[model samples]
Target: MSRIGKKPVDVPSGVTATVNGQDVNVKGPKGELAFRVHDEVVVEFKDGKVSVQPRTESKGARSKWGMSRTMVSNLVEGVTKGFEKKLEISGVGYRAAVQGKELVLALGYSHDVKYPIPEGIEIKCAKPTEILISGIDKQRVGQVAAEIREFRGPEPYKGKGVKYANEFIFRKEGKKK
Candidate 1:
């Protein structure tokens, strides 16, 4: 039995949830989102809560049970509170700015790196060294943040580059003189 699958996802007030076959859709104050669960699991909504169950006792079904349940719950949470990822620039002269719908980054390169913002995702530069990515889709927000960080990953020597705000960089000892 899957522990997480046993718990139902409660639909909070002012939020709407619907289950159609293997598809689950949630609409909340933040926005709307949907997810398609695997056929190995069954989805149902009753008494203001959504539940997931394995179709059979097979191992494949059991393996998807918990994952399907969590995906449904994430849809509810994502549509309500949304998701956010923050990145910090640590290198000298490295900074970020939003130009219209694009993110202009200066990572010590000869030319500035321009990243076009995708739909449904919002990118904001609270400070020259801070980048905030927010969206209802958790995957999209994370992907965008990863793409931005990929431009200049943190180096182990000086630990200089772009990284998650809460991330810890492992520093390496400098070369011998």
Candidate 2:
């Protein structure tokens, strides 16, 4: 049995959740979000909570059980508390700025990299080296952060580039003289 799948997702006060067939929708003070669960799992709402269960005792159903439950929980959390990701730019002359609707990044390149911000997502530059990304959808927030980090991943030698705020870069030793 899946431990995560067995636990029901509690719908906190001021947040509303609904299950329509394979779709789960959640609305809260912050915003609203929805998710479509796999056919191998069944979703239900009751007692101010949402639950997910496998439709059959099969490998596919078992694999999707916990995933479906987490998706429902994420929908509720996203609509209520939302999600956030922080990126740190580290390199000589490297920095970031929010220019209107685009994120302008200078990662030691000749030209500034401009990234157009997407709808429902917010990007802010607290400092020249700090990028804060927030959104109601967890997946979208993470995706945008990943895309920015991919532009200049941290190098093992100098450990310079865009990296997650909490991430650690395993530095490598320089060649011996």
Candidate 3:
């Protein structure tokens, strides 16, 4: 049996969950998220909690069972509390700004890179070097942040590029004299 799958997901007040066939939909104050449960997994919501059960005790069923349950749980949490990603800009002239529905980034490139903001996501720039990304969908928020970071990946030598606020890059030592 999967330990994670055995744990029941607590349903918070004001959040609603519905299961339709294999599809699971969760709605909360922030937004709504939907997921499809695996064929070998069965889910139930009762008494302010959700539970997942595998149809069989096989290895494949056990493995997928936990993942399906966790995905459902994450969907619930994401809709309730939303998701956030923070990015920091490095380099002398590299910076970022929000222009209407686009994110304008100057990452030491000859021309500025413009990224269109997707719907249901919000971008905030406290400073030119700091960026905040917020959205109800955890996957999309992370994807957008990763794309922005890929625009100018951190260099090993100077570490001048965009990176997650808490990310760390290892610096290489200089050659001996």
Q: Who is ahead in lDDT, 2 or 3?
A: 2
Give per-residue CA lDDT, model 1, range 6-116, as digits (tens).
999999999999899888889999888989999989999999999999999999999999998888888888888889999999988999999998999999999999999
C-alpha lDDT of residue 94 in model 2: 94
lDDT of 2 by residue, 12-32 (tens): 999999899998989999898
Q: Name the regions of candidate 1 deviating beyond 4 angstroms.
A: none
TM-score of candidate 3 on Cα atoms, chains taken together: 0.95
Number of clashes recorded per candidate = 0, 0, 0
Q: What RMSD value applies to candidate 1? A: 0.9
Error of 1 at 171 (Å): 0.7
lDDT of 3 at 16: 94
Question: At residue 147, what lDDT does model 1 achieve?
Answer: 98
Best by lDDT: 2
Candidate-wise lDDT, in order: 0.93, 0.94, 0.91
Compared with the true structure, what per-residue lDDT tens digits does model 3 show for residues 84-121? 99999999999999999999999988999999999999
lDDT score, residue 13, model 2? 97
